[model samples]
Target: MKPWSFLHISDLQPGSPRSYRFNQAMGENADTAYKQLGEVEDVDLLLVGGDLTRDGAIHDFECEEARDRLGSLPYPFYAIPGNMDTCNKHTSVAGATGRDDPRLNVTAEQLDHFALFFGEFPWSFVHKEVRFSGFYGAVAGSGLPHEERMWRWLEDELPPAGETKHHVMVMHYSLFIDSVYEPTWGLQDKEEYGRWYFSIDQPHRSRMFDAFKRSGVDIVLSGHIHCRKPPETVDGVRFYRCAGIAMPQAANLWPDGDTRLGFYRFDVTEEGISETFIPLEKESTAEGKYGPGGHPHPEDRDYSLAWEEPPEEFRT
Candidate 1:
């Protein structure tokens, strides 16, 4: 069976000096990973999940810097916008007041800038027998209009009734699993602030998941939880959350000490798909700790190397 490999990373919010430093380190890591991948053989593409910025600030230089770093790779790369990347008002409010606010609006300028930079790709695409789609922002009703339009596109674009193979959907937010369902880690509790971001209600989220299942999407990639954990399977759709490339934060709305900073790699073949988590090297971790002690740390840091084999269903 022919094989293909691609890099998957998320939450590369390069805003503050700390964010910049983190991204620099992540860029270095990506280079190392890519080199190692090259040694192994060929890598077909790089898929970056979202939250590419800190606050979606128009003046944020990190965005450009990130583009430069990511662009250095030899492989063709594609990306989507996360809540932070979307320029929604919540980011500004949270930044200015240091408090959660849900009354924010996604600015026209931010959307325009993102579209210009990203070239207005569809919410989804197909490459090498793999179908890829992504949804932006949180899953709440706050961005309903935009979310609706995206869904409409997805519904229209879904391969006709019974198409199958390796179908993968990538999004900034997790539709199934702890990130969206578990009360403690789910976005429901954060409804007030979530409204400013994005998150659909229970019925809508369920409906979305059903749509993916019906569409025969085998795997879903997401990031925003910041915790490096195994992929969770629900209703036959496997959801994998890529760890943030920058500073770590609370995992799934959990208290501060449960996040891990890292990235992921997906290997695809005619047979199936497999994913592995490539964590920051020891030197990088130490730098993350000593260089900036301010960032939150995970409890009982389980940085040990672990790989979650794709469930039986995903093994084509």
Candidate 2:
């Protein structure tokens, strides 16, 4: 069979100045990634892992802009929603500090709004003998109606969907921090909060892992961590903790983590699939930005500090 190539990129969150928050560096970084993607050659397809916009859930204009930017890519790209594009995972208990967790819980309305620009997800399709599947894994334990549909799709629809040479799965959150059996991280534990934020919780993780096996998934590409972890193999599946396009994080958390801004290029040959890390030719160092970091509460947002006049649409 002839060889083919594909690209996987995520977390571009190039925020809008019109929004309550703005980050100039992240905007430049995502623009750089976008330019770089056009230069990549012989790519059969592009897999956009997620975090396509900074405040896409709240700002409809951001989502619309992202659709145009990504649509301009040289090759066809399939995408899944990242937490930033919709909402964070469900949690009734508030975190130890900062924003309340329940407020961050993803709602059906949020997901539906995202689909208005990016199309419906938990999508699976075959191209060139490869099964490319993408989903918002953060929805797993949310208890939302969308979560029910996600479960039904993963459990009932995909596994039976015909065979393929390789199944490449794309998700926004890593299924686990390290091992498949690692305990879920708690929101109250300062030491474990990062872990908790980056991974899917228990029962759900194991359940999803099982579904992957049943569906013949061989490679799992996840991007929430923003740190590039060396590929790990569990059971028969290869898990790739992909690097971020917008910014880097959790560099010191893992000894081998590569905290570089870039994307992954995978070549599919008759033998199998191989991955190459394409680091951004330049990482943005621009400063002088305005915005509250982390998950800030709605009440805490300060539009007065915006560098540009708030767009009429964003005005309360």
Q: Against the true structure, whose TM-score is highest? A: 2
lDDT of 2 by residue, 100-151 (tens): 7888899899999988899998899899889999999888888888899999
Q: lDDT tens digits, residues 1-316, model 1?
A: 6787877878766443333123345444444443543443367777777766654444345467557666666776788877666644222234223333443445545655665666463466777767776665443344545556666666666775356587787777666444545332232344444322333346557666767877788888877656655676776778775677656654455332235665667788766788877665531433332123222222321222112222233222
Model 1, stretches more than 4 Å misplaced?
16-41, 88-100, 137-140, 143-145, 176-200, 251-258, 282-316
lDDT of each: 0.57, 0.89
TM-score to true structure, per model: 0.71, 0.97
Return the clash pairs for model 1, or none: 138-198, 138-199, 139-198, 139-199, 139-200, 140-198, 140-199, 140-200, 185-252, 257-299
Q: Give the residue spans of candidate 2 off by over 4 A.
A: 160-162
Best by lDDT: 2
Worst 10 residues of 2 by lDDT: 307-316
